[model samples]
Every structure is written in C-alpha cells, then in structure tokens.
Target: MYLTAVASLRAGHADDVFLLKRPGWVRDTLKQLDEAKRLSGGELFVARWMSGVVRAQVPGLFGERAAAMQDLVWCLAHADKAPNLGWMREVYFHLAALHRQRGEDAAARRYQTLSGFASETRPATFTTPFSEAPVAGHTFSSRLIREVVPGAVYLLSGFEFTEYYFVVSADRRELIAIDAGTRADAARAAHEALRARVPSLPPLTTVLVTHAHWDHVGGQRYFRSLSPSPRFIGRGNYKDELAHDAMANPAGLQLFFGKEFQLADVLSYKPDVTVDRPTELIIRGTRFELLPTRGGETDDACR
Candidate 1:
C-alpha cells in the first residue's frame, strides 16, 4: 500500500512534474500516507520515512503556490521531524517573504529571525563578466574572448559582462548553447559572432542554464524560438527562481524592473530535465557532472 501510494506520485511526463503541485493533492497524499502508516503497524518505518520526505519537500515542490501551501500549523506539527535547521533555512526564508508580502510585519520578522543566516550579510553585488575578476575561474580582456579546447567552444561577452557559450559537438553535427546574453544587443552580438565565425554549426540540441538570473537567461527566448529549438536542462527549483526573479505575479518583475517592466518577454519556461541534486549528463558522448553549489552568484545557481 505504501509502495502503491508512492508510485502514484511518480512523474509520468515533463508536464506532470511541474503541474501537479496543488495543495489539494498534497493534502490528499499526506492523508493516504498517514493511512498507510497506520495499516503497516510494526513495519511502518518506510511509510514514516516517506511522510518525512514529503513534509520536507512540500514547501519547495509547491514553489510559487506558497500563499496557499505555506501553512505554519502544518510545519509546526512536524517540527520534530524536520531534518535540521540548515535544511529548513529556505522554508523559513519563504515563510518570511510570504508574511512580508501580506503586510504582517511582526510575523515576517519572526520568521526572518528564525532563519539561520543574516539576510543583510549577503553581497548585493555579483561578480559578472563586467567585473575585473574571472568568471568561474576563466579570465577575459577587451580583446580576448573565452574558448574551450578540443571542440572549439566560444563564449560571447556582454551585460554585467554576461557571457554565453556556443558549444560545438565533437563531430560538429550539433550545437549546445549555455545561457543567452543579458539583452537584445548582447544576444545580437553573440548571434552575429556565431554567424560570422561558426556559420557551419548545426541546430542547437540542448541548453543548460546555470541559473535563472536576468543576465544569464535574458536571451533564452530568442534562442528557443529558433529552428531546431533545444530542450532546457536545469535544477528542479529553476521555475521557482524564474517566478521569483521575473514572473511571480506582483513581487517578481514589478519589484525589480518596476511597473513599466514588459511581461511579454519574461517567461517561466519548464526545464526538460530537472536535477534535484548533483547529476551526470552525457551530451553526444561527452560526460559532465553537474554539482550543486551553496550559490556562488545566485541562490539558484549550480556549478
């Protein structure tokens, strides 16, 4: 019965993974798990473990649906079951944000205080291509552009010194892009550079987004609309980050870019493959292990 309940929740397709995050489903699932736990008697450990997993994941799995899903009572009931304070940090932050959004200053402050880290201590500035420092340990100058060996990959530079890569396959039959430039001009420059130098390159087959920051994803739509549109690969919370940064109704674009911000270009695209933790990828026989970071440039970033 426990296995049956778990199997029912498995994602059968890309859409199911992101679409089935409603609170009603969670409530129903929890009820079923609790029943299974009761029925299992002495062998209830598996059901108990699964229940704990759902409790911890429910906060994030619902992402932008926080207003309806962030039930403090539910969390308090399972406080003892929480893995650790560090694991609960994001949950605390989200609760704080939700309270703050609703004008409950006292409640907001309470949740913020509960968060393990001081929010103000984080740097407001990020080291981008515009910074004198190297990006991911690769340096570039006004005249120098970034390049990777063997297959001859090109990294175009622009906005916050935004750098996007154009990866050519080992057999030159496919192109794999990484991030689009910050804006139209930057994307145009990258596109033009590709046309002028790598004209023979084939259609893009895949795009791996390092994070959901504006500088990294601004040009994604431009690339996605192109012929032979590529499938996106990113972390599971990638959509939530997109919602937070660009599309979360009021607090997203309105707060950052202002009310004048155009909603047309901003999109919350689903990743074809979502990684919950460090995972390996093989692109055209090339193996790459994606590792999660404590967030170097942004909280959603992976190294």
Candidate 2:
C-alpha cells in the first residue's frame, strides 16, 4: 500500500519530495499499505527519511510544535518496516542533523553513537567497529594552523568541534588569536606551529571567542600557556553563556564521547575580556570592533 500511494502521488509530480505536515498521513497510509510490499526498498526508505527529517527537524514549522516528531516516531515504531538506519550510519547522520537543529547536541550524539560514530572524536568514527571499515573519505587535523591571509589572518583546524583563528598586525609585531579548539593538544600544536614557521610574528596579545559554546572555548585554558598569556575576550553575554555551559557541561560527556578522559575531568572555559554593547578598541595599532549576535548556531554567537 505504501508503494501504491507513493506511485499514485509520483504519477502527477515530476519531483520526489513531498512535505506533509500531518503525522497521520504516514501512519494512516502505511497502516493500509499492502503487507506484501517490501518496506526495505531504498526509494521508500528515502521518502520515509524525508518525512522523518521534516518532522524531527522543525520546532514550529507546523502550527503544532510539540507533536512535530509524532509521525516520524510512529514510523520508527514499525520494527520491521523501519530502515536499518541504526548501524548503517546514513540515517544516523540525518537524525544527528535533526537533533542539532533542535539544539540537542547530546541527544544527536546519542543517536550517532549507535551508528558507531561520535563527534567528540576526530571525524566521529565508530566506537564499536562492527564491519571492516575502509579508509574514511574525510580526515581532520586540528594542529595544522595555516595562514588564510598572508601575514595577517590564520586558521587552525583545532579539533572535531573547535577551530581557532589568528589575526596579525601589518607590522607582524602584535597578534590576536580566536577560539581555541576542544583541548590542550590543539592549542599546543597551534603555538608550536606559529613558533616554528614565523618565530618573529608578533606576540599574541588577545584571544577572542565567537561564542560560549564548549567547542569554541573548551581549549581556552591552554591559551594561557602561550607566551605572555593572551587575554581571552568574549561578548558581554559571555558570562551567561558560560553559566549555561557550566550547568550543561556535566551532561555533555554522556551526550558525546569524551576523548582520552573521564566525564568528571571535562572542563569548560572562562573568558577574561567581556565586551558589553558594541565596543571598539585600538590596541597596538589594530582596531577591533566587537558586536554580539543572538543566534546563528548558539544563543551567544558574537562578531
């Protein structure tokens, strides 16, 4: 019956995507679908995945916000028809994306773990290595800090979560780094790289964080380890963001796998410089204007 209904719908439309806000659509239709139809077919699975994602992702895209995921949940309840999305990794990625849209990183990572991948790691490879895996198409290295702008802007792909940035003065006498990644390793590597390639490149006087998310500030402590200990700067809401993280930090370990340490050892960052309102500063001939943003990915995204 599922295929029959989909076929009827597809007969008129050239496209495959359909957006039905009603959860009853899938439940009622699937309930009447011919039992002989194979639910495991890839096309059907894609249709179901779209249905699940739309429902699971939106907070109030529909008039009813609370029951958004109800249809998707119903589909998941069908033990047999449901796709092997659990360990297959594909559906797991979509579910993770939906959860992230809901601002539930922990919840997303929980689903991600069942698929044998944890974002807390490098590229979130499987924890339980079920099948002989091939070389990952994607690899991440945080320590390699490369200059995006000659003698000026630099970026360090710090970790799976955090990426750091550096801005140097025209004279190469003063510099500021931004957003240290998730741990001390990235910080140490970034400093070592800078020291090796451009030993004469300015002293890091300030380090600015774009937001208060753990991935943005987790490795902040290690910035103090750099020469002269650059001051950490964040928006005025920085304290509130930190307070929020401090409350949620404990649960983070359970959400995403903690790399190389126990949950109790995980630490959140504290900012040194706070800019309230739009503020402009001229330090060592470099002008910086700090502005706060309400939300892009987090509640405290700043510019």
On TM-score, the leading prediction is 2
TM-score of each: 0.45, 0.48
Instruction: Put down candidate 2 lDDT per residue, 80-141, tens digits, no spaces.
Output: 44333332354455556556667998978876675465563336433231221121111143
Error of 2 at 142 (Å): 7.3
lDDT of 1: 0.56
**C-alpha RMSD (angstroms) for model 2:** 16.2
lDDT of every model, 2 decimals: 0.56, 0.55
lDDT score for residue 288 of model 2: 79
